[model samples]
Target: MSRRTLVAGIGNVFLGDDGFGVETVRRLSAPGAAAARLPDGVETADIGVRGVHLAYQLLDGYDTLVLVDATARGGAPGTLYLIEAGADGPVAPQTPVLDGHQMSPDAVLALLDTLCAGTGAAPPRRIWVVGCEPGSLDEGIGLSPPVAAAVDEAVRMVLDLVHHQDEETPQDEPGVAAN
Candidate 1:
């Protein structure tokens, strides 16, 4: 069976390397880009700084969700990490905050959990996060040199996660384990 997958890029373009996700998806969706060759049932969204929108969109239902964003874990700036969620089940937050501007993937998931429960919508069956260690998130309009160089690799990693689950690399590598 084919999987309906949403690959969402979330972050703030003005916050230096935080734009990593935004830029990566831009390349992925470009004409003749690698994602163009993928089969149907895959969609890409540049949900820049709009975590609430992402959470609401999830209510539409999907088999899989892949979120790409700048995730900091004290590694080298270009290091990549893949985190899996939804396999275990949706989050059960004690007190969820539904911030309109909560852009981090975790916060989005928390908000999603609440939404799905209230609306009786099922969350994605599987979720993955393709993250890049950022050189800086300070106010800026562009990525640092290292983070900029990592965008291509990040795109490849996202594709790999979407197509080949067994070959995922971050199971060995470590990062923020949640969200």
Candidate 2:
């Protein structure tokens, strides 16, 4: 099977702003939603702290992967970061700005890699992470105003990238495929 696209949101619902990713998915999955207009073959999921279960969704085969999460690295609130996985940097697990989830994003990715290796499957060709800096990650329940606003921007960024890729990729010619 060719690679499909997967958008996995990871976070903690109990923690304020930590639920940004899951909340985004929930918003996307609404009835008669605009998210339905997303490209065909693109699937989205809310995998809050359940990174181990990611293998099942990811196993199907996906070329592009987008992960949305709330992060804090001393940046301004609602800061958006588009980071490529396995880029030139140390893949260290950072301490959570707010203690709610059991595993960090990098740890989840590592677990996914281990699962893929054990099953002899290839990982996605591209992995983009969209991070929103949080104003609060406390033991509260809702997203801060700034972080909430960032979700719209994050969705737009992901959608634009997907459409761009769809346009750039060539279709099959006769019996030859670009892949």
Candidate 3:
């Protein structure tokens, strides 16, 4: 069987650096670009600012989930991060109340977890984040220079991840836990 992967770009294009994910995915999906280079079973989507929609999409079942977004990890702008959401499961940290319009990657994962529990759907077996350090997420229409520069690199990283997973033999059925 083949591994199914979903590369979801999540962010708000209206915000400055917050649009990294959207931009990266846009580049990947461009004509004769990264999307054409991808292998079978790999899918991409720009889930811009719609966390609820992304959460529901997760229920569709994928072996691996790659979330591309601008993450504030206190690094210089354009710094890329590959974060493996631990095997333990989604971490739910107490945060200030959020409105319907905003949802961070962590929040989306938590929501997916809750929704999965209710629907009895299995969450993706592995979750990886291709995050970029943002220079600013202030109200604006475009990315900062550094963030814009990192889009191509982020796209490469995501492709590498998908290819790497494709080469590995699964130790268990896609999303099913092995004892």
Candidate 4:
């Protein structure tokens, strides 16, 4: 069977910079936008702050999951990062704390792990994160200057990732890479 991929954008639009994921997916899924250029069997959604919902969605059985979000890795704002989840091993389960208002990527993954453990559902075969370094996640609307500037680039990155022709070579450690 061909690979099934889900590109989920996670974050809150009300919060500054945190909306990177949501905005990127918005552009991708926009009418006559980049999403139409994607290959078949790929789906995209803006799963904002809904960790539980996202976890449940994962149970549908996709071969790959590409999560787009703002990740603070102590880098300059607007820096893009490509992270391969479970690169080492299964993620350790964290205490289940279901917050309806907010859910970080880590939390969502942990929740998925827990949910899968009970249902015998195998997690996605591969997971990648197209993350951006946020300038600020404080209460506000829209993205910061640098982060805003990176949106188009992030969209391009996600497209490349979904196409399985990522421009950057995989590295041993997930570090800040060029946009």
Candidate with best lDDT: 4
lDDT of 3 by residue, 1-179 (tens): 77788999989898899999999988887878698988799888999988878888989888899888888887789888877775565477343224347677777888888889999998888888888899998998999998898888788888888878755432222221121
Candidate 4 residue 114 Cα shift, in angstroms, is 2.3
Candidate 4 Cα outliers beyond 4 Å, as residue runs: 93-95, 165-179
Instruction: State the lDDT of candidate 4 residue by residue for 1-179, as single tens digits.
Output: 87788999999989899999999999988878696888898899889888778889999988889999998888899988988887777666344448755566777788888888999997887888889999998999989999999988888878878776333444322335633
RMSD of each: 3.5, 7.8, 6.3, 3.3
Per-model C-alpha lDDT, please? 0.79, 0.71, 0.80, 0.83
Q: List the residue pairs that clash in candidate 2.
A: none
- Weakest 10 consecutive residues, lDDT, candidate 2? 170-179
C-alpha lDDT (0 to 100) for residue 2 of candidate 2: 49
* lDDT tens digits, residue span 1-179, model 2: 64488888889989999998887766665555458767787788888877656655677678888787886666778877666677665355564323334667776666657667889877777776767788998998899998998777676766665666555432222211111
TM-score of each: 0.85, 0.81, 0.86, 0.87
Clashes of each: 0, 0, 0, 0
Q: Give the TM-score of candidate 1.
A: 0.85
- Tens digits of per-residue lDDT, candidate 1, 134-174, equal 99989989999988988877777777667664344333433
TM-score of 3: 0.86
lDDT for model 1, please. Answer: 0.79
lDDT, model 3, position 13: 90
